[model samples]
Target: MSRRDPYIIRRLNFRKVVVVTLISLLLVILILFAFITESDIPFNLQNRIRVHREHPSLILVDLMPAFVFILLYPMHRIMNRAIGEYEDRVKESQMIVDRNTKFARELSEGEDPEPYPEMIESELGKALRMIQLNIKSGRRKEKEQTWIAEGKDIISKILREYHDPGELSYQILQALNGYIQATQGAFYVFDEVEGRLTNTATYAYNRRKYVTQEFRIGQGLVGQCAYEMDFIHRTEIPDDYVTITSGILGDRKPGSILLVPLITNEALQGVLEFAFINPRIPKLTIQYLLELGEIIARTLLNLKLNLRTRELQEESRQLTEVLRRNEQQLQENAREMQSAQQKLESANIQLENKIVEANHAQSRLHLLLEYASEVISIYDESFRLTWISPSVINILGYTVEEMMGGKDMERIGRNDVVRIRKMLEQLKESPGRIEQLEYSFIRKNGERIFLRTYCRNMLEDSSIGGFVLNTTDITESKQVEKEQRLKSRMQSLSENSLDLIMRLSASGMIHYVNPVVEDYTGIAPGSILNRSCGDVAFQKEFAELMGRILSEMNRRPVKKNLQATLPMLMGEYRAERILSVDAIPEFLDGELETILVVGHDITEAKRIEKEIKVQNRKVQDSITYAERIQSSILPEPAHIRKAFPKSFIYY
Candidate 1:
């Protein structure tokens, strides 16, 4: 219903009032003329005849007002209808202006603008459309300005938090995703050292399910964007292109994908990828994305340079500390040498005055050797111990007095005796060089201990020494090396397994995930750690089922094998996969601790099973149809028997 304008009604009323007033005045004039003609006043006959002849048409004029009055209602109705239509058009034009104003405000506020009204062929509608176009242009300009200001603000924030590249990338990606209403996005930074692109952060994405984290300069869409240093937008995405999953809603096929390269100063720094549910992104939005991409590129470059500067500063600090420590050590060594020189000079001065005191000095040297950790023994040419340090008691479980005259080789292992003899012979042959050998020796307690022995022959010692042996226990170090090798092997096996392996806490939070998850779910392992399984499940039912299973496993604290049909996201599609999961519960002190889950992907088998069921149903339908055809076409047994009765038919 169109609203009537008050102005149009007032104008119509004014026209009616004028027509009535004119009719009333003409009636008055006619009445006055009749009165004058019938008055008693005398008049000339000639004047009366002239006046009568001139006023001949006055009678016709007197009837004209009546005819006008008769047509007044029809004329007023026509004029009113025309005026109402004009008022309706004005109202429509006002509505268009109001709607355009709203759209313009929304644009300036950085909100989604409403679409333009449909075009109308009427003149008023055409004028409204032109007005809307002009308004939209102004709104778009305002939106661009708003976007520019927002981008600048975001870039400033990113710069403030640019100390860590991972954090910076995450913040930038989150901001971009929010601005564009993206379903998912990832940021990949170019690693100059590795010569590849590596995923640094993601928004609404499972990094553990990312199949490929490293890309060459021209590898895929992300790499291609980097190579071209431009943005790539695809609206009609293929089914298996990429998968984006949200909690409980399952996986979704993206309607559009955008890959933008972050390039600054002719250098490719990174790539940003976004998945969107909207197929047709607005032109203004695209322009904003491009401008934001430039800001991100420059920011990334700055982050790299800042990181390099920090690294260099850290290295310089470390080098300075090392040099300072080395200088201190060198000064200490020089002081020790000077003190030793002064002691030697004092000993030379006292040698002539007291030969007995010099002999006592040798005994003090032997006493100092007993305080060392390593066992020191002096042997004669026959390999008999002439003197031994008290450390021999700790290393060989033998007293110094008992080992003083005993053969040093007596406690050596039978297998190592020949090697010991060979080392001793080599020391004797090359007295200028020291000989080192590792061997095992039996202690007094009958325990075998590995020892690394350094032997040096004394050629001109008047104190009657053949060789000085320094032996260090190396048993603990050898054991540590053996354990490290075993651990390395185990870690390699776990990392290379083809099954999806995960470890979860008793509370159902993921503690670890192996690399095989990437092959199945396209998520990276590092991204899922410490996150609840419910947060990453493909469906709500799956999350609930897993929670229940985890609770039961925690209660039972036992190993279990289970089979379930789960919805798994494969690329941009959701597939019902049959998973054969093995849950191994780990316990400490009889209490449940962690659970290890290993799952095998059985989607292909499930697909084959569904196909077989479909085929079997078709076969059953065919068999039923065949039975019906036989029943319809073939004669009844009774009728056949009747027809063949004369011929003596037999069954």
Candidate 2:
């Protein structure tokens, strides 16, 4: 009933009760008057007495029923009004409950749960509370049935074809649309390198548009969800917020959103956000959406982890194949290189013989010096002051007298003189061009000459003539070439060495390591290097192995071929290595005096060995099968017994 209807009924009942009570009293008075007039005995006296004596019971009888009726009417009206109000409230509450239950069931049923609440405050909160209650009540069986079937199909398709995590995430968003109504959404995960959450997947109504966005840990709505580890309500968000959702949703306006936290174990995974086109959606429905979002988050995390594992596995397989191909190529190239090297060596020897013959034919012959090419002299076996060719003035910037001065040794740097002496000695043994070496000589101007010279020793009948020098200034080239060669040689050694070569200082710091360690440990070079190799590469088991191998070899340089398995790599590895440890009192590059470690990588060899084992098993199986067949070709035991009974089967 409307609020005013009960008051109208009560007023009408009160008026009817008053009218009935008056009519009943009038009837009683008339009856008493008629009775007194009909009797006619002392009429005047009796009428006076009767009028004076009123019966209490009769008066009460006339008014009691009307009084009771009037009193009961108001009481009944009050009771009815209260009950009616209560029933109305129950019905309204039931309607809200039903809506919530429907939303959850629909989600379980793979039906689109509407997105009305943007940020928890409005109708969305009520909607979410209802959904929570329904879920708690376990009334989502029907919904879960449909969701399970559809979700299974979706997950199957993702596993079968969507290898890329981004693509799989997109498919996941699409599948979520089957359950929740949303205009846009995004998936994010933490980037370990950058230490921030980055968008890995997105679902927007307009596929043609794009958004460039990022969030700090606690900067925006999504960030709050991640950092606070709780749901962020839209109504709770302040205006003039730093995080403008406009770029994500087309127009630059604040829309209602419910930022739900996605967390697993001890880590905050990410936040899921739903954008609504219509702002009037009830808060309760939005709550329902948040619960659904949690499910999606869990599934996404698991799929992502699985995808990463698969990627690692695939990468390992590809690397192994590449390594195998490279090894084969190296073997073939080594053969071809050997043949080419022999040919080159023979050609060099023949050229040396011809040059020797030409030098012997011309003694003290003056060949006019060309541009930058000159005749020069160094001491013979006695190491005395030698003759200076006239071309020395042009090449060394010194006159012949100064070049041939008795103090020529004093004029050059100790290093330069030592190198020249070395070169002359080398010439006596072999005739070849002297490689460019850093040296300083005194110019005629008395300035130090930092020159890079290429020289060839003058030889006569396998004996040293004076050394012929061709020098040039190379102060800049020396520095540049030294750095270039250092880097080049380091890179080449890292790539070409079959062994795992690492350099360490006395502090046990790993300065450098080859890439071959990954084959044995499955840990990437980037992850392990620069860290303590003893801690990471040689864990408890491998460390023990190293100690044991060192001790068992009786301190002698040893060779070991071993097999081991690491739990992280999920496989066994066979390694063949030669350990030649020698103490260096003064090692190059200031290395530890007691440190000398040499080991080679033999993962491929180990793999081949395993393959050989498998092949051997197959061969054994084949032989057993063949033997069975051969035995089958022979006579039965009973027949053999019968045939050999007399001779006791001696044959």
After the best TM-score superposition of candidate 2, give how far the Cα of residue 163 lies from its true spot, in angstroms: 5.3
Pick by TM-score: which candidate is best?
Answer: 1
Mind giving the per-residue lDDT tens digits that candidate 1 earns over 1-651?
Answer: 335455657576768857795976678466546644676533555644455566666555556666666667677767777777877778877787676667556655756654664435345546655656777788878878988788769767876866688878777777777777877888888976555788877676433223336665545567656655667777756454443211111257677777877767667788888887888777666677777777777877887888799999999998788677777688876886799899999978876656564456446545645655588767777766777778787767878876765635788766678887777777777753567788777788888778898777864344434787768888887657644643453365558787878777788877677888666555677777778887774356555656766988967877888777766666899767677788888775466767778888777887888899999999999999998998898888789878887654433
> Which residue runs does candidate 1 get wrong by more than 4 Å?
1-132, 205-212, 238-252, 327-651
- TM-scores of all models? 0.32, 0.27
User: Backbone clashes per model, in order?
Assistant: 11, 20
Question: Candidate 2 at 79: error in angstroms?
Answer: 31
Give per-residue CA lDDT, model 2, range 348-389, as digits (tens): 998898677546533323333322244345555556656665
lDDT on C-alpha atoms for all candidate structures: 0.70, 0.57
Compared with the true structure, model 1 gives a TM-score of 0.32
